[model samples]
Target: MTDRIQEFFRQRRAEGRDLGPCLVVDLDVIRDNYGAFAKALPDTRVFYAVKANPQPAVLDLLARLGSCFDTASVVEIQQVLATGCTPDRVSFGNTIKKERDIARAYELGIRLFAVDSEAEVEKIARAAPGSKVFCRILCDGAGAEWPLSRKFGCVPELAVGVLEHAHRLGLVAYGISFHVGSQQRNPRMWDGALKSSAAIFRDLAERGIHLSMVNLGGGFPTKYLRDVPAVKAYGQSIFRSLRKHFGNRIPETIIEPGRGMVGNAGVIEAEVVLISKKSADDQVKWVYLDIGKFNGLAETMDEMIRYPIRTAVDGDEMEPCVIAGPTCDSVDVLYEKQPYLLPVSLEIGAKVLIEGTGAYTTTYSAVEFNGFPPLETHVI
Candidate 1:
């Protein structure tokens, strides 16, 4: 474990704390990350995706930082509003909101919304008349950790039709939006999405519809098991793409960063419950933790999201072990196919820390499953 993490736990233990499964968020790191994005994209508006970490402290801090919010549900909208942020600064980024929720958002003074289909556009038109809406175009999701495969966005042609339909329905079809998917590593992914967006812009202009904005949607990456480029690099790529595709006519830009803004600021501390071999002559050592997939680490689906893990035990030699979560579900195994290395001296009751888990853990945890409580959280 890193000295800082060890010292954090050491201090807690010195105060006679129970070292159970808990998520620790460093607010300072989140602040620094917000500053980095602001500096990287000077004139762009940031709508921090609240689905990343809905913790009150996280939302309050971002609101105090003068950041807008990208809310997905009515509850999220209420949460952002409770922080004293106006609804105008919020975007209903989810394209799947119900008609009642749409009307509720509009009643709350939110004018910005996202749409991906004709049905959604019609619903928004009736529920939130004259609202400013953006159409989401499908993405290839290349080099992204979480590739959205036709689950949310539409084809460019379909998006163009959707926006036109919105305009006909007395709604302001302001711009286009697309997600390169979460934890995107390749900057070229934005290039293609931007070029496609530009094509849509031209098509709309040909029809005498002038748009004012373009939402890049969040896909910014954070460092984890693999190295990721700096926010500045992503900024450069995005600006270059905008310049290349839209030229001097680039519209107002917006970013809705969720993982990139908070992923690295969160860490989960768990305890080892058991260590043993599954069978005789088995070369693999199995280590079980108190936390698992349903508890909070649901992002480990298919082991695609790998978190950097460390044990409190210190040793000169390390051995690989299959980590599992303490759940009745057999699928609670965290790293069975890909063994994680830990000190051979690791034992039951040792604490393990999982780094870079701030974004998806809490929001995705089961409320109460397998008799395990929801993941506990602490902010620093």
Candidate 2:
């Protein structure tokens, strides 16, 4: 956490206004993260994934930094455009889209689209004729914290047919794309996907359709309870894999970073609601916070992402505790399977700081769940 955020909480407490869980995002951190990504992949373009965090201030900052956008919906596209970014800099990255949305995006000057099936290609060709379309292939999401497999991409062979159908239907078969997974910690994971992409490139070239680009989909991770590699490490590994797989002719490339772009730039401050035990003989105490899965900590689902939580009594004696949220839902518990270690002196009304939460919290927050308002956000 930054000093500015600490001061914000201090002032709020001084005014007796630190009443609810809120997220504070530091724009300076985002600016530095953008510069790091740009430097790491100098030859490749950076497309900020709007689904990660679509705050207006975040969008405006990235736009001014000369970053393109990967939007999942028309509303996200509009949010990016509201920052004065041209439609040419935005890609409709979602494969499963309504034909009407494709038409709408085309009307809005979006010429780049993602596809995984011939049906999708046909829709795009009919809606946005001659637009650039890239086919996504499936990758076994090995070594990723939150694996993104099975739902989005087609097989490599199917991708070829989809792109070929797009070519026949008057669409520009642009290139190949694959996501290694989200929060992938292994830098070497890009090698296998790049190898598949190279094979697709060669197969299409033999059929007289030469591709020009490869969308190296985002898997870059942000620091959490466990440390992750630096962006430069991923960049070097990816560059080396590109040379090994597609020698002499590295196609024009781009990266879509969501978590790595903004996950570390934000922090959440939550108040301890209650501290209790289930039974008289129970050794573990249940510590409930004002924030929960429905509010701002949805990433804790399946215990995949364990955020680093800090409190004023962190330096005191510690013990394992069952952490939960202040909700009536039975599944609101965050650390039941793997209990979190916290100070034994932690009590009700204590304020805790959750770090590395800049990307997904605000966007995932629910509105009026349990009569609790959405996660309030302040961009500094």
Candidate 3:
């Protein structure tokens, strides 16, 4: 956890404020992150991904920074609009959108959209005529913490056909986009994706269609339990890849960042509901918390993602414990497969602050499941 986070929790505890399962966002950190990315990629346009942490405060701040928005739904588009952002600054980034949602986005003045298949291209053509569309080409999602595979993005050939169909159907074939996946760690992975994009641009040029934009969908990494390279490193690698692939013919570049921008800016404060030892001989203690998978930490599925947790319990000795949620569901277990150690003196009513939770927590939480209220977010 960052020093600011530790200090924030310390001050909250000093003030005796209720921190019950609340997701706290530090807007100043978010602003610094945005500024860092903007400085690193001076030539690239940033459209903050709305699906990460769509807190109105986040959107409002980015809007004031002159950042565009990458919205995945009509509600997200409306949220960006409510921040007084111009329609052209919002890109309907979801490739698989409902027809009515497309119409509504168009009605609200969203001109840029993302599409992956010919059918979706046709849907956009019919629903939002003359709209500019970008085709999402498939990537292997290598070196990414969250592999967004099989659900979105099409093969390059399919994407080419989709762009062709979009042009034939009277919609503007504006650009090509691809996601390297969420929490992408290896910056070299951009090489192949950019090469494929270059090939598509050449193919489109052969067909007398000159695409003028390239949307590098979000895969930027954030500091979690593991360390990642600095944002400047990612920018340097991307610029090198663009030069290697497109040379001087590079199109207008855009990056859609979700977790990379907000993951470290937030933390979740939860209370220990109970501690149980299955039997007298049981070595692993079950530490139950008020927040769990169904509540706001579903990213722990299969133990792929781990959040750094801190506790107020003070001691020199620590012991490995099994952390589980308060839910009765068997799958609510958080760290049974992985080692999670807390102070040996930790007990019920102790507050545990989970870091690197800003982006995925509130957005992915279930609403009022298991008689517990949904995760509440507090932006500072």
Please name the candidate that would achieve the greatest lDDT relative to the true structure. 2
Indicate whether candidate 2 or candidate 3 has the larger TM-score. 2
The candidate, 1 or 2, that scores higher on lDDT is 2
Note the clash tally of each candidate.
Answer: 0, 0, 0
lDDT of 3 by residue, 48-155 (tens): 999999999999999999999999899999999999999999999998899999999999999999999898988899999999999998899988988886788888
Decoy 1 TM-score against native: 0.97
lDDT of 2 by residue, 329-355 (tens): 999989989999999999899999999
| Ranked by TM-score, top first | 2, 1, 3
**Is candidate 2 or 3 superior in lDDT?**
2
Give the distance in Å from residue 213's predicted Cα in candidate 1 to where it truly belongs.
1.4
Q: List the residue pairs that clash in candidate 3.
A: none
1 or 2, which is superior by TM-score? 2
RMSD (Cα, Å) for all candidates, in order, is 1.5, 0.8, 1.7
**What is candidate 2's CA lDDT for residue 336?**
87
Please, what are the lDDT tens digits per residue for candidate 1 over residues 260-333? 99999988888999999979988889999999998899988888899988765655488889989999899999
Cα shift from native, residue 117, model 2 (Å)? 0.4
